[model samples]
Target: MAQKGLCWKEDEMGELVHTGTSSPDISVIRSLAMKHLPGSYDTMDVAFFAEGSFNKLYCVSSPHLPQDYLIRVALPVDPFFNRESEVATLAYIRKYTSIPVPKVLAFCSSSESELGFEWILMEKIGGVPLSDIWDEMPVEAKESLPTEICGYLKSHQDLQFIKIGSLYFSLVRERVGTRDFGETSAYPSLPIVVLSHLHINS
Candidate 1:
């Protein structure tokens, strides 16, 4: 498979940096959401929710849904590797630690998908950003923040991987790796390892 080239934009420092500017089709998005989302597509509402350096997020909600879901569409910047690794890492965290992370309901790592981009459909985690209320937080609350943050960090440190590369689902690793790979420290699912070849063509 041919590797997709990375997108670049000028940073504040005037240096070129990889940047993601994916804008997924809303109509197709609605169709995709309707597949897993509850309620009639005609009654469902899909709205832009958020954006990060590498992804554009959309919120999907319908009267029939138990809760709203987030659709994250990633830009072409690492194409397959970024999304696949992220799903694997999130799965690793949820399986191994007490850290709260979004639950992935469905995902597609291929840019060639029906939506024309890689996407993840996940349960929306409810909470306000810490930055929004940091100043309003009481001194006592601020004091304990570090401890709470460190607790999550500590949990990550407890996990040990034999290989230094990113984690991946066994299926993804098999599809991308040059050969069958060995398992790592009993991570709930099959283990994966090492660099660029970890992407899934599917």
Candidate 2:
């Protein structure tokens, strides 16, 4: 028989153990699998692959299908944290470019029922994540990645104002300002180069 979702392991003091999957609030894995997926997978089992501060990622498979897809369950971190916007952004990117993003299968925003969290079902991309590849990838591949990313940006250069938000730069500014003072601080600078190229191309 297939294994069910993991249960919280507790300590002798009756407090929850610090497992990677343990969260302070709740787990929406089962609700997401049952509600968002196709009718065929309504009764299928789900296994949690990972969880982030903002979302829980799971791999779901059934006897009917040979493969599994990823489900991203958005945790309500704040009122302004919109899972719908993230889904829409993914959909918009997929519609405009062939840069290969996860294909959005379904998205739900209502938070009224058993599925208390907003979620998105997306086609899983196969490959080692970029983090895993960092140490293994060749220098040439590393160099080419930036070029490929730049080409992707260039492809969407002609996008209308409505398609891409107007305050995109401001978003970048905010991210830069709020970023940690460590290695991650460099991320905010990449937008400057990309924006400069975009301006020239437009």
Identify the candidate with maximal TM-score. Answer: 1
Q: Rate the local accuracy (lDDT) of all candidates.
A: 0.77, 0.54
Models 1 onward score TM values of 0.79, 0.55
Q: List the candidate 1 regions with Cα displacement exceeding 4 Å.
A: 1-22, 38-42, 138-140, 178-181, 186-202
Q: Write the per-residue lDDT of candidate 2 for residues 1-202, one digit (tens) a residue.
A: 1111223467899885333332322345655555656665535667777877566877877776555778776655321225544554565567666668898877665444355556677877877779977999899999999999898888677444322222222334443233222212323332221111112212
Error of 1 at 199 (Å): 8.9
lDDT of 1 by residue, 1-202 (tens): 2223336768899988874344678989988989876446567789999888777899998877888999998877666677888898888788888899998988999988888888999999888989999999999999998999899999989988665566667777655554444666464344545434443548
The residue pairs in collision within model 2 are: none
* Cα deviation of 197, candidate 1, in Å: 4.9
CA lDDT, candidate 2, residue 195: 19
